[model samples]
Target: MKKVDTNKYTKLTLSLERIRGIITELPHNGHRFVVLYDDKPDKQGYIQTILEDDTLGEQSPYLLETRVYHTEDTFSHYRKSCTKAQEIFPYFEDFYKDIPFSYENWEEVTKEFLED
Candidate 1:
Protein backbone atom coordinates (compact mmCIF):
# COMPACT_ATOMS: atom_id res chain seq x y z
CA MET A 1 0.00 0.00 0.00
CA LYS A 2 1.11 3.52 -0.72
CA LYS A 3 1.76 5.71 2.25
CA VAL A 4 -0.76 8.50 2.61
CA ASP A 5 0.48 11.95 3.37
CA THR A 6 -1.81 14.00 5.60
CA ASN A 7 -0.44 17.52 5.45
CA LYS A 8 -2.66 20.53 4.62
CA TYR A 9 -2.62 23.38 2.13
CA THR A 10 -4.06 26.84 2.72
CA LYS A 11 -5.32 29.59 0.47
CA LEU A 12 -3.66 32.93 1.03
CA THR A 13 -6.16 35.71 1.37
CA LEU A 14 -5.86 39.36 0.44
CA SER A 15 -8.37 42.09 -0.20
CA LEU A 16 -9.33 42.95 -3.75
CA GLU A 17 -7.84 46.40 -3.39
CA ARG A 18 -4.64 44.97 -2.04
CA ILE A 19 -4.37 42.54 -4.90
CA ARG A 20 -4.88 45.40 -7.30
CA GLY A 21 -2.10 47.25 -5.60
CA ILE A 22 0.22 44.29 -5.96
CA ILE A 23 -0.53 44.16 -9.65
CA THR A 24 -0.14 47.84 -10.16
CA GLU A 25 3.18 47.86 -8.34
CA LEU A 26 4.73 44.98 -10.23
CA PRO A 27 7.45 45.83 -12.73
CA HIS A 28 6.53 45.87 -16.39
CA ASN A 29 6.79 42.52 -18.18
CA GLY A 30 6.77 40.84 -14.85
CA HIS A 31 5.83 37.19 -14.48
CA ARG A 32 2.18 36.50 -15.07
CA PHE A 33 0.05 35.12 -12.25
CA VAL A 34 -2.22 32.08 -11.92
CA VAL A 35 -3.59 29.97 -9.09
CA LEU A 36 -2.76 26.27 -9.45
CA TYR A 37 -2.08 23.42 -7.05
CA ASP A 38 -0.94 19.84 -6.71
CA ASP A 39 -2.21 16.81 -4.73
CA LYS A 40 0.57 16.17 -2.27
CA PRO A 41 0.75 16.33 1.49
CA ASP A 42 2.58 19.30 3.03
CA LYS A 43 1.29 21.50 0.28
CA GLN A 44 1.36 24.94 1.85
CA GLY A 45 -0.73 27.35 -0.21
CA TYR A 46 -1.36 28.67 -3.68
CA ILE A 47 -0.66 31.97 -5.38
CA GLN A 48 -1.89 33.29 -8.69
CA THR A 49 1.63 33.88 -10.06
CA ILE A 50 2.42 31.79 -13.13
CA LEU A 51 4.77 32.73 -15.91
CA GLU A 52 5.82 31.40 -19.31
CA ASP A 53 9.37 31.69 -20.55
CA ASP A 54 9.24 33.69 -23.71
CA THR A 55 12.91 33.42 -24.61
CA LEU A 56 12.66 29.76 -25.39
CA GLY A 57 11.54 29.34 -28.96
CA GLU A 58 9.56 26.15 -28.55
CA GLN A 59 7.86 24.17 -25.81
CA SER A 60 9.24 26.17 -22.92
CA PRO A 61 8.30 24.98 -19.49
CA TYR A 62 5.54 26.95 -17.79
CA LEU A 63 6.48 28.21 -14.36
CA LEU A 64 4.07 27.44 -11.51
CA GLU A 65 5.86 29.32 -8.79
CA THR A 66 3.81 30.20 -5.70
CA ARG A 67 4.91 31.68 -2.41
CA VAL A 68 3.37 29.65 0.42
CA TYR A 69 3.94 30.22 4.11
CA HIS A 70 2.68 27.57 6.49
CA THR A 71 2.92 29.50 9.73
CA GLU A 72 2.08 33.02 10.88
CA ASP A 73 5.45 33.43 12.47
CA THR A 74 7.21 32.42 9.29
CA PHE A 75 4.91 34.54 7.20
CA SER A 76 5.39 37.53 9.42
CA HIS A 77 9.12 37.06 9.59
CA TYR A 78 9.48 36.84 5.84
CA ARG A 79 6.61 39.03 4.75
CA LYS A 80 6.71 41.69 7.42
CA SER A 81 4.75 44.23 5.44
CA CYS A 82 2.12 41.89 4.03
CA THR A 83 -0.80 41.71 6.42
CA LYS A 84 -3.03 39.37 4.43
CA ALA A 85 -3.95 36.27 6.36
CA GLN A 86 -3.95 32.70 5.20
CA GLU A 87 -7.34 31.53 6.41
CA ILE A 88 -8.58 28.88 3.95
CA PHE A 89 -6.90 25.51 3.79
CA PRO A 90 -8.22 23.20 1.12
CA TYR A 91 -6.71 19.89 0.20
CA PHE A 92 -4.76 20.20 -3.01
CA GLU A 93 -6.38 17.10 -4.53
CA ASP A 94 -9.81 18.73 -4.42
CA PHE A 95 -9.28 22.33 -5.37
CA TYR A 96 -9.21 24.28 -8.61
CA LYS A 97 -10.63 21.38 -10.60
CA ASP A 98 -12.37 23.41 -13.23
CA ILE A 99 -10.34 26.51 -13.77
CA PRO A 100 -12.07 28.17 -16.73
CA PHE A 101 -9.04 29.52 -18.55
CA SER A 102 -5.45 28.68 -19.41
CA TYR A 103 -2.55 29.88 -17.30
CA GLU A 104 -1.87 32.41 -19.97
CA ASN A 105 -5.15 34.07 -19.14
CA TRP A 106 -4.45 34.54 -15.45
CA GLU A 107 -3.70 38.24 -15.56
CA GLU A 108 -7.15 39.04 -16.89
CA VAL A 109 -8.98 36.45 -14.82
CA THR A 110 -7.14 37.35 -11.65
CA LYS A 111 -8.09 40.97 -12.06
CA GLU A 112 -11.67 39.92 -12.61
CA PHE A 113 -11.73 37.34 -9.83
CA LEU A 114 -10.37 39.77 -7.28
CA GLU A 115 -12.49 42.67 -8.37
CA ASP A 116 -14.80 43.98 -5.67
Candidate 2:
Protein backbone atom coordinates (compact mmCIF):
# COMPACT_ATOMS: atom_id res chain seq x y z
CA MET A 1 0.00 0.00 0.00
CA LYS A 2 1.06 3.57 -0.71
CA LYS A 3 0.67 6.41 1.74
CA VAL A 4 -0.42 9.78 0.49
CA ASP A 5 -0.44 13.17 2.13
CA THR A 6 -3.61 15.16 1.51
CA ASN A 7 -2.14 18.21 3.19
CA LYS A 8 1.28 19.49 2.31
CA TYR A 9 2.01 21.02 5.70
CA THR A 10 1.20 18.26 8.14
CA LYS A 11 3.68 15.60 9.21
CA LEU A 12 3.21 12.13 7.81
CA THR A 13 2.61 9.03 9.95
CA LEU A 14 4.13 6.05 8.20
CA SER A 15 5.90 2.81 9.00
CA LEU A 16 9.66 2.53 8.92
CA GLU A 17 9.45 0.43 5.79
CA ARG A 18 7.58 3.13 3.90
CA ILE A 19 10.02 5.75 5.12
CA ARG A 20 12.94 3.60 3.96
CA GLY A 21 11.36 3.26 0.52
CA ILE A 22 11.20 7.02 0.20
CA ILE A 23 14.79 7.34 1.37
CA THR A 24 16.00 4.85 -1.24
CA GLU A 25 14.40 6.93 -3.97
CA LEU A 26 16.17 10.10 -2.95
CA PRO A 27 19.49 11.14 -4.47
CA HIS A 28 22.58 9.78 -2.71
CA ASN A 29 24.96 12.37 -4.13
CA GLY A 30 25.21 16.16 -4.21
CA HIS A 31 22.14 16.60 -2.06
CA ARG A 32 21.16 16.36 1.58
CA PHE A 33 17.72 14.83 2.09
CA VAL A 34 15.30 14.73 5.00
CA VAL A 35 12.73 12.06 5.84
CA LEU A 36 9.83 12.69 8.21
CA TYR A 37 7.77 9.94 9.81
CA ASP A 38 6.54 8.44 13.09
CA ASP A 39 8.31 5.16 13.71
CA LYS A 40 7.54 4.88 17.43
CA PRO A 41 4.75 5.44 19.91
CA ASP A 42 5.61 9.08 20.03
CA LYS A 43 3.36 10.96 17.63
CA GLN A 44 5.76 13.88 17.48
CA GLY A 45 7.40 12.43 14.32
CA TYR A 46 11.06 12.12 13.36
CA ILE A 47 13.14 13.92 10.76
CA GLN A 48 15.97 12.06 9.03
CA THR A 49 18.50 13.93 6.96
CA ILE A 50 21.22 12.49 4.76
CA LEU A 51 24.22 14.67 4.11
CA GLU A 52 27.01 13.97 1.66
CA ASP A 53 29.88 14.08 4.09
CA ASP A 54 33.06 14.49 2.10
CA THR A 55 35.08 13.68 5.20
CA LEU A 56 33.87 10.12 5.08
CA GLY A 57 35.67 7.62 2.91
CA GLU A 58 34.54 7.07 -0.67
CA GLN A 59 32.90 3.81 0.38
CA SER A 60 30.69 5.75 2.80
CA PRO A 61 30.09 9.29 1.68
CA TYR A 62 26.84 9.98 3.49
CA LEU A 63 25.98 10.97 7.03
CA LEU A 64 22.51 10.20 8.36
CA GLU A 65 21.17 12.33 11.19
CA THR A 66 17.87 12.07 13.00
CA ARG A 67 16.07 14.82 14.83
CA VAL A 68 12.80 15.04 16.69
CA TYR A 69 10.21 17.75 16.11
CA HIS A 70 7.45 18.35 18.57
CA THR A 71 4.23 19.47 16.94
CA GLU A 72 3.47 21.89 19.75
CA ASP A 73 6.91 23.46 19.50
CA THR A 74 7.42 23.38 15.75
CA PHE A 75 8.47 27.00 15.73
CA SER A 76 11.78 25.97 17.28
CA HIS A 77 12.55 23.18 14.82
CA TYR A 78 13.39 22.82 11.14
CA ARG A 79 10.32 21.68 9.21
CA LYS A 80 6.82 21.28 10.56
CA SER A 81 6.39 18.03 8.73
CA CYS A 82 8.38 15.19 7.23
CA THR A 83 10.68 16.46 4.46
CA LYS A 84 13.40 15.28 2.10
CA ALA A 85 16.07 17.43 0.51
CA GLN A 86 15.44 17.79 -3.22
CA GLU A 87 18.68 19.47 -4.23
CA ILE A 88 21.95 20.88 -2.95
CA PHE A 89 20.81 24.48 -3.03
CA PRO A 90 21.78 26.92 -0.32
CA TYR A 91 19.38 28.14 2.35
CA PHE A 92 20.13 30.51 5.18
CA GLU A 93 18.08 28.38 7.54
CA ASP A 94 19.38 25.27 5.83
CA PHE A 95 17.60 21.98 6.63
CA TYR A 96 16.40 23.51 9.86
CA LYS A 97 13.80 25.52 8.02
CA ASP A 98 10.20 24.43 7.67
CA ILE A 99 9.53 22.02 4.86
CA PRO A 100 7.62 23.52 1.96
CA PHE A 101 5.82 20.34 1.03
CA SER A 102 4.28 17.15 2.50
CA TYR A 103 4.42 13.44 1.93
CA GLU A 104 2.30 13.71 -1.20
CA ASN A 105 4.80 16.16 -2.58
CA TRP A 106 7.51 13.49 -2.57
CA GLU A 107 7.20 13.12 -6.32
CA GLU A 108 7.22 16.87 -6.75
CA VAL A 109 10.51 17.21 -4.83
CA THR A 110 12.35 14.16 -6.13
CA LYS A 111 11.12 14.40 -9.73
CA GLU A 112 14.14 16.31 -10.97
CA PHE A 113 16.67 14.27 -9.00
CA LEU A 114 15.26 10.96 -10.18
CA GLU A 115 15.11 12.12 -13.74
CA ASP A 116 18.80 12.94 -13.61
Candidate 3:
Protein backbone atom coordinates (compact mmCIF):
# COMPACT_ATOMS: atom_id res chain seq x y z
CA MET A 1 0.00 0.00 0.00
CA LYS A 2 1.10 3.55 -0.62
CA LYS A 3 2.08 5.36 2.53
CA VAL A 4 1.13 8.94 3.28
CA ASP A 5 3.97 11.43 3.17
CA THR A 6 4.73 12.37 6.73
CA ASN A 7 6.16 15.71 5.69
CA LYS A 8 3.06 16.56 3.70
CA TYR A 9 0.34 15.47 6.11
CA THR A 10 0.28 16.44 9.75
CA LYS A 11 -2.12 15.87 12.62
CA LEU A 12 -5.01 18.32 12.60
CA THR A 13 -6.41 19.92 15.72
CA LEU A 14 -9.29 22.30 15.36
CA SER A 15 -11.80 23.93 17.68
CA LEU A 16 -15.15 22.24 18.30
CA GLU A 17 -17.02 25.25 16.97
CA ARG A 18 -15.06 25.14 13.73
CA ILE A 19 -15.72 21.45 13.40
CA ARG A 20 -19.43 22.03 13.89
CA GLY A 21 -19.39 24.61 11.17
CA ILE A 22 -17.80 22.15 8.76
CA ILE A 23 -20.46 19.53 9.43
CA THR A 24 -23.37 21.92 9.18
CA GLU A 25 -22.66 22.78 5.55
CA LEU A 26 -22.35 19.21 4.36
CA PRO A 27 -25.04 18.55 1.78
CA HIS A 28 -27.48 15.90 2.96
CA ASN A 29 -29.14 15.50 -0.39
CA GLY A 30 -26.84 12.97 -2.08
CA HIS A 31 -23.22 13.50 -1.16
CA ARG A 32 -20.85 11.43 0.93
CA PHE A 33 -17.67 11.99 2.95
CA VAL A 34 -14.84 9.73 3.97
CA VAL A 35 -12.56 10.34 6.91
CA LEU A 36 -9.03 9.20 6.17
CA TYR A 37 -6.02 8.71 8.40
CA ASP A 38 -2.32 8.75 7.81
CA ASP A 39 -1.29 5.27 6.73
CA LYS A 40 1.68 5.11 9.05
CA PRO A 41 1.93 3.09 12.23
CA ASP A 42 3.64 5.48 14.59
CA LYS A 43 1.99 8.46 12.93
CA GLN A 44 -1.55 7.25 12.62
CA GLY A 45 -3.70 10.34 12.71
CA TYR A 46 -6.44 12.10 10.81
CA ILE A 47 -5.26 13.24 7.40
CA GLN A 48 -8.35 14.52 5.65
CA THR A 49 -12.02 14.02 4.89
CA ILE A 50 -13.03 13.22 1.32
CA LEU A 51 -16.33 14.09 -0.25
CA GLU A 52 -17.99 11.60 -2.57
CA ASP A 53 -20.83 12.71 -4.72
CA ASP A 54 -22.82 10.69 -7.22
CA THR A 55 -24.74 13.13 -9.31
CA LEU A 56 -25.19 11.15 -12.52
CA GLY A 57 -26.65 7.92 -11.28
CA GLU A 58 -30.35 7.37 -11.72
CA GLN A 59 -31.71 6.16 -8.43
CA SER A 60 -34.81 6.97 -6.47
CA PRO A 61 -33.70 9.59 -3.98
CA TYR A 62 -30.23 8.39 -3.19
CA LEU A 63 -28.95 8.85 0.34
CA LEU A 64 -25.48 10.14 1.16
CA GLU A 65 -22.84 7.74 2.48
CA THR A 66 -20.32 8.60 5.16
CA ARG A 67 -17.53 6.05 5.58
CA VAL A 68 -15.30 6.31 8.61
CA TYR A 69 -12.14 4.31 9.08
CA HIS A 70 -10.36 4.08 12.38
CA THR A 71 -6.94 2.67 11.64
CA GLU A 72 -4.73 0.79 14.03
CA ASP A 73 -1.78 0.54 11.67
CA THR A 74 -0.84 1.08 8.06
CA PHE A 75 -3.13 -1.66 6.75
CA SER A 76 -6.02 -2.18 9.11
CA HIS A 77 -8.83 -0.17 10.61
CA TYR A 78 -12.44 -0.53 11.67
CA ARG A 79 -15.02 0.79 9.29
CA LYS A 80 -18.31 2.49 10.06
CA SER A 81 -20.57 3.63 7.30
CA CYS A 82 -23.61 5.83 7.81
CA THR A 83 -26.00 8.08 5.90
CA LYS A 84 -27.22 10.56 8.44
CA ALA A 85 -25.21 13.58 9.54
CA GLN A 86 -26.11 12.82 13.16
CA GLU A 87 -24.36 9.46 12.85
CA ILE A 88 -21.05 11.05 11.81
CA PHE A 89 -20.25 13.05 14.93
CA PRO A 90 -18.95 10.20 17.04
CA TYR A 91 -16.37 9.31 14.45
CA PHE A 92 -15.25 12.91 14.20
CA GLU A 93 -14.91 13.02 17.96
CA ASP A 94 -12.82 9.87 17.88
CA PHE A 95 -10.49 11.20 15.20
CA TYR A 96 -10.12 14.88 16.00
CA LYS A 97 -11.41 14.93 19.60
CA ASP A 98 -12.32 18.52 18.66
CA ILE A 99 -13.73 19.64 15.45
CA PRO A 100 -15.41 21.87 8.52
CA PHE A 101 -17.55 24.63 6.44
CA SER A 102 -16.68 26.25 3.05
CA TYR A 103 -14.37 23.27 2.40
CA GLU A 104 -12.30 26.06 0.91
CA ASN A 105 -9.82 25.31 3.67
CA TRP A 106 -9.87 21.63 2.73
CA GLU A 107 -9.83 21.99 -1.05
CA GLU A 108 -6.08 22.25 -1.46
CA VAL A 109 -5.21 19.24 0.67
CA THR A 110 -7.97 17.09 -0.76
CA LYS A 111 -7.10 17.97 -4.30
CA GLU A 112 -3.44 17.26 -3.72
CA PHE A 113 -4.24 13.83 -2.30
CA LEU A 114 -6.66 12.97 -5.06
CA GLU A 115 -4.29 14.08 -7.74
CA ASP A 116 -1.53 11.97 -6.27
Candidate 4:
Protein backbone atom coordinates (compact mmCIF):
# COMPACT_ATOMS: atom_id res chain seq x y z
CA MET A 1 0.00 0.00 0.00
CA LYS A 2 1.18 3.61 -0.71
CA LYS A 3 0.10 7.18 -0.21
CA VAL A 4 -0.64 9.93 -2.71
CA ASP A 5 -0.35 13.69 -2.66
CA THR A 6 -3.05 16.23 -3.34
CA ASN A 7 -3.75 17.93 -6.65
CA LYS A 8 -4.56 21.62 -6.78
CA TYR A 9 -7.64 21.28 -8.94
CA THR A 10 -9.62 19.02 -6.60
CA LYS A 11 -7.40 19.62 -3.60
CA LEU A 12 -9.91 20.60 -0.97
CA THR A 13 -12.90 18.48 -1.90
CA LEU A 14 -11.20 15.11 -2.36
CA SER A 15 -8.70 13.32 -0.15
CA LEU A 16 -4.98 13.70 -0.93
CA GLU A 17 -4.92 10.07 -2.00
CA ARG A 18 -7.73 10.75 -4.43
CA ILE A 19 -5.77 13.40 -6.29
CA ARG A 20 -2.19 12.08 -6.39
CA GLY A 21 -2.08 10.36 -9.80
CA ILE A 22 -1.03 13.47 -11.72
CA ILE A 23 2.43 13.31 -10.10
CA THR A 24 3.72 10.15 -11.76
CA GLU A 25 4.59 8.86 -15.26
CA LEU A 26 2.47 5.75 -14.71
CA PRO A 27 -0.41 4.88 -17.02
CA HIS A 28 -3.56 5.67 -15.04
CA ASN A 29 -5.74 3.80 -17.45
CA GLY A 30 -8.82 2.96 -15.37
CA HIS A 31 -9.27 5.54 -12.64
CA ARG A 32 -11.25 8.72 -13.01
CA PHE A 33 -9.02 11.14 -11.14
CA VAL A 34 -6.03 9.23 -12.39
CA VAL A 35 -4.98 10.93 -15.62
CA LEU A 36 -2.64 9.16 -18.01
CA TYR A 37 0.15 11.50 -19.02
CA ASP A 38 0.55 10.26 -22.58
CA ASP A 39 -2.70 8.65 -23.71
CA LYS A 40 -4.83 11.80 -24.20
CA PRO A 41 -8.05 11.23 -22.28
CA ASP A 42 -10.92 13.63 -23.04
CA LYS A 43 -13.17 14.17 -20.01
CA GLN A 44 -12.69 14.43 -16.21
CA GLY A 45 -15.37 14.70 -13.54
CA TYR A 46 -16.64 13.44 -10.17
CA ILE A 47 -19.19 10.83 -9.04
CA GLN A 48 -21.01 10.94 -5.74
CA THR A 49 -23.23 8.83 -3.45
CA ILE A 50 -26.12 9.36 -5.83
CA LEU A 51 -26.20 10.14 -9.52
CA GLU A 52 -28.18 9.53 -12.65
CA ASP A 53 -25.32 9.10 -15.13
CA ASP A 54 -25.02 5.35 -15.71
CA THR A 55 -21.59 5.43 -17.28
CA LEU A 56 -19.93 7.10 -14.31
CA GLY A 57 -21.34 5.42 -11.24
CA GLU A 58 -22.07 2.24 -9.26
CA GLN A 59 -19.66 -0.39 -10.38
CA SER A 60 -19.71 -1.98 -6.92
CA PRO A 61 -22.85 -2.86 -5.01
CA TYR A 62 -21.43 -1.83 -1.64
CA LEU A 63 -19.97 1.44 -2.82
CA LEU A 64 -21.76 4.66 -3.44
CA GLU A 65 -21.33 6.75 -6.57
CA THR A 66 -17.72 6.69 -7.71
CA ARG A 67 -15.97 9.53 -9.46
CA VAL A 68 -14.99 8.98 -13.07
CA TYR A 69 -12.87 10.30 -15.89
CA HIS A 70 -13.63 9.51 -19.49
CA THR A 71 -11.48 9.34 -22.56
CA GLU A 72 -12.76 9.26 -26.09
CA ASP A 73 -12.62 5.49 -25.83
CA THR A 74 -13.77 4.73 -22.24
CA PHE A 75 -14.43 5.64 -18.60
CA SER A 76 -12.31 5.26 -15.42
CA HIS A 77 -12.27 5.65 -11.64
CA TYR A 78 -10.13 5.02 -8.53
CA ARG A 79 -10.51 1.53 -7.11
CA LYS A 80 -12.40 1.39 -3.86
CA SER A 81 -10.20 1.99 -0.73
CA CYS A 82 -7.03 2.62 -2.74
CA THR A 83 -5.31 5.96 -3.11
CA LYS A 84 -4.51 7.17 -6.59
CA ALA A 85 -0.80 6.59 -5.86
CA GLN A 86 -1.29 3.12 -4.40
CA GLU A 87 -3.73 2.40 -7.17
CA ILE A 88 -1.02 2.96 -9.79
CA PHE A 89 1.48 0.38 -8.50
CA PRO A 90 -0.61 -2.66 -9.31
CA TYR A 91 -1.54 -1.39 -12.75
CA PHE A 92 2.01 -0.37 -13.63
CA GLU A 93 3.41 -3.64 -12.31
CA ASP A 94 1.13 -5.51 -14.62
CA PHE A 95 2.01 -3.14 -17.45
CA TYR A 96 5.75 -3.72 -17.05
CA LYS A 97 5.54 -7.48 -16.77
CA ASP A 98 9.10 -7.90 -18.04
CA ILE A 99 11.55 -5.13 -17.21
CA PRO A 100 11.05 -1.63 -18.58
CA PHE A 101 10.27 0.61 -21.51
CA SER A 102 11.43 4.10 -22.40
CA TYR A 103 8.40 6.07 -21.43
CA GLU A 104 8.53 9.74 -22.29
CA ASN A 105 8.95 12.14 -19.40
CA TRP A 106 5.90 13.10 -17.33
CA GLU A 107 5.49 16.86 -17.70
CA GLU A 108 6.09 16.85 -21.41
CA VAL A 109 4.13 13.69 -22.04
CA THR A 110 1.13 15.03 -20.16
CA LYS A 111 1.40 18.30 -22.01
CA GLU A 112 1.55 16.43 -25.28
CA PHE A 113 -1.51 14.35 -24.37
CA LEU A 114 -3.48 17.36 -23.23
CA GLU A 115 -2.57 19.36 -26.30
CA ASP A 116 -4.02 16.65 -28.51
The TM-score values for the models, in the order shown, are 0.26, 0.31, 0.39, 0.20
Per-residue C-alpha lDDT of model 1 across residues 28-107, encoded as one tens digit per residue = 33424434443445544443432244354223333332334446323211111111212111211223432222233222
Q: Assess candidate 3 and give its lDDT.
A: 0.36
Task: Give each model's whole-structure lDDT.
Answer: 0.31, 0.36, 0.36, 0.30
> In candidate 2, what are the lDDT values of residues 40-110, reduced to their tens digit?
45444334445354344233333333333445444123322223332222221232233433333232232
Expressed as tens digits, the lDDT of each residue in 1-116 for candidate 4 is 21221232322333333333332322322333332222223423332221123253333221222223345544433323322334334433422232232222211122322424
lDDT of 4: 0.30
Q: Compose the digit string of candidate 3's lDDT tens values, residues 1-116.
A: 11211222334444545554445444432223333343446544442332334353222222222222244322322223344445455555554432322222121322222323
- In TM-score terms, candidate 2 sits at 0.31
Deviation in angstroms for 26 in model 2? 1.0
